[model samples]
Target: MLTSYTIAVIGGTGPQGKGLGYRFARHGHTVVLGSRSAEKAVPVAEEVAARLTGVDGAGAVSGAANAEAVAQADVVLLAVPWDGHDELVGSLDLAGKTVISCVNPLAFDKRGAHGAVVDAGEGSAAEHAQQLAPEATVVGAFHNVSAVHLWGEYDYLDEDVLVVGDVVEAKQVAQDLAVAVTSRRGIDAGKLRLARVLEPLTAVLISVNRKYKVNSGLRISGLEGIER
Candidate 1:
């Protein structure tokens, strides 16, 4: 039998990861919050259940270490940071899975701005991840969403998520997950190669938010009518 469309948030104990985990659970999909340490993920999973207690059709969420969680999960969200990206990618068996990458490669010091030192030559973090996990259909998403904003009580009444990937079906799965979290619509920003643009844009947004001391997000006004 085919597995249920359960979602797994690898490294999902953190802000962005937990946010997606909570969203997925609230939408009634079983969510496994995967972490480097399963013990650490347990508290985070409990927090997701507490935060989303009142949502309709909500289901239970659990925790596990990364490898174990991904093995049984249908949709996998890669939420580990740039520093651990390579190591995390190397640990997975992603054949035929839909892997959504929510990472941005940034190198910044306390005093200044440093750009990403990319490994893919193409400079897109998502591309690098996809190259490492060739059998998985990798898609770029949630790059621009601030972790703080994501974990907080933002209604996200309507927002825009830039979804990028080479495979159409993979991108659609990523978009479906995005919509479950918000009334926001996800716009397919074309092949994962375009993630070169999206990833750096995240750094720019970080710089802006750091200077402004408020949540900063990119939202496009005209996308709601297109209906993808």
Candidate 2:
């Protein structure tokens, strides 16, 4: 049975966030497209609603300010860039909510994109988020999925999401949401600390995508018939 959840994407006006909002809404979850500018968020939600017209719960999306969206959601996904991550997350009160972050700490240069060495003392961006929202159950996920593929019109999304968190149920909530989006598999990659491993791997995927001119993602093989 699929659990119906109300999800709020904090950076939902952006490509990654909009794509996720669309997917969740298509699957009957109430999706809130949150942004610093509520004005921008509205149109993004409207567009998602238009795309999801024939879906089972097409009208399940809306837009709002970041704080408002967080207030209404059963779960919150952070898709904001790393530059503004700390400030944006620090301003919110996410106590008692399932907060999922996919922010990869990376930087681009003339050469190519590379993972930024995290100096926050916490290891990764997800850990930084965990520190920002102490009362919230923070789970790291969606780090390696491509924004382009996420918003593409493919019949199904074929990829794997690595979900990591200290809390058992919180990780389950993150995994459930991952599966809710599409046929993609969400694997429990262990404790919150493992975010250190998953975050930088995104940079490697980016490098590969650029080199091959493909929107590639992650897939851990050798595990056959793994139960979700």
Candidate 3:
């Protein structure tokens, strides 16, 4: 019983956002790719829609201004950069919405990427998001999913999506979306606080990608028969 949702992806012009929007549309969810302005987002949405024109089970894809997109959807995904996170989230009215935060706070240097220190909430981008939008049920997920693999031609991605949140129902929505993307397990990793660990963990995966010259992802074992 897959439920269709109207998903608004903030920063949807970015690679990660566009990739996730494609998957959501592929699964029959109406996807609105949000940018600072409709002008920027519309072309990208048209491009994505063009790519999915004949794909089976694909749903409608559109574009709008960030706030307008959020106003039109029940579910909103924050995929913006860490630098503009607070201001963008604070400006939006996310009351009574299921908000998914996949914005990893990371900084790159000559030494490669590392987790940037988050000053608000519990020191993770998700927690900070929750802090800014107290009325929104925020869930942390899709942090480690590769944009490259997501945009690839594969029918299903091969990896586990770890979901963390304080609210059970909101977390379940994220987990369901994860399964929608992977068609596999979406593990309930733990509470929202665990986002502290998960956000930083992406840096490690990025390093692995650089070292191996491949897009790497996570897969958990030992839960074959257990319900997620």
Candidate 4:
């Protein structure tokens, strides 16, 4: 059995953040949906809580300002837009928490969306997060999971999330959280430096999603240890 965690989602009003927050809350984790405006977040969090009326793990949702969310969470998931990544991290003091970086740096034009080439000065988003919050155990994950499926389509997620981080215990916490969200498995893709490769993969999945009109996800073939 996994220990229940107070999970804070930074951009919890947005589609991706909201979906992830909903799933976590429905599975017994305490979810704090955070937004720049507390007014906006509170309503959305209430709506999500209302939807879980008859669900098994209901009534565990709440909302707050971004700073308060981080202050109260055992694990923080950074789901903000790439443009806002630096500003958000700099303002928070994530001294000894487990931080998961789920931002995929990407851009779009007339043709389609593509991964933005970020210098990061350190490595990738997770690595950059490590620099900003030097005492936090930052992990890169949730890059390939579809927000649509998370919120609207499936009750049980059958996908693999590539979890990359230097800290072993933090990575295990991420993997456990992944499993708690309806059987989704978190695969240890490598160390935190590997995020440079994992982040760009989201762009390719988006391009395919545009073509097929499907909220497609990844499945690892040979991961025997990860339970379904």
Question: Each prediction's Cα lDDT score?
Answer: 0.80, 0.86, 0.92, 0.86
Span of 10 residues, lowest total lDDT, candidate 3: 116-125
The better candidate by lDDT, 3 or 4, is 3
Q: List candidate 4 segments past 4 Å from native.
A: 120-122, 182-184, 225-228
TM-score of each: 0.91, 0.95, 0.97, 0.94
> Over 4 Å off in model 2, which ranges?
120-122
Q: Candidate 4 has which clashing residue pairs, if any? A: none
Which tens-of-lDDT digit does each residue in 1-228 have in candidate 2? Answer: 767889999999999999888877776789999999789899998898888877765538899999999999989999999998999999998999999999888888998887888865348889999999999999999888888987888755777788999998999887887775546557899999889888888889888998999998877787677576
Q: Enumerate clash totals for all models, in the order shown.
A: 0, 0, 0, 0
How would you encode candidate 1's per-residue C-alpha lDDT over 1-228 as one tens digit per residue?
212368889879888898877766766778999998889988888888888777877878988988888987888888888897888887898887899998878778885554586755566768878888998889999888777767767665245688999999888887777766566547888988888888878878877878988667778776656876
What is the Cα-based lDDT of residue 55 in candidate 3? 86
Worst 10 residues of 1 by lDDT: 1-10
lDDT of 3 by residue, 1-228 (tens): 767899999989999999999999988899999999999999999989999988898989999999999999989999999997899999999999999999999989999999887765358989888999999999999999999998899888988999999999998888888866899647888899899989989999999999999999998989888988
Model 1, position 155, has a per-residue lDDT of: 62
Estimate, for each residue in 143-184, the C-alpha lDDT of model 4 and write its tens digit: 888988888857777778889999889998888888755486
The best candidate in terms of TM-score? 3
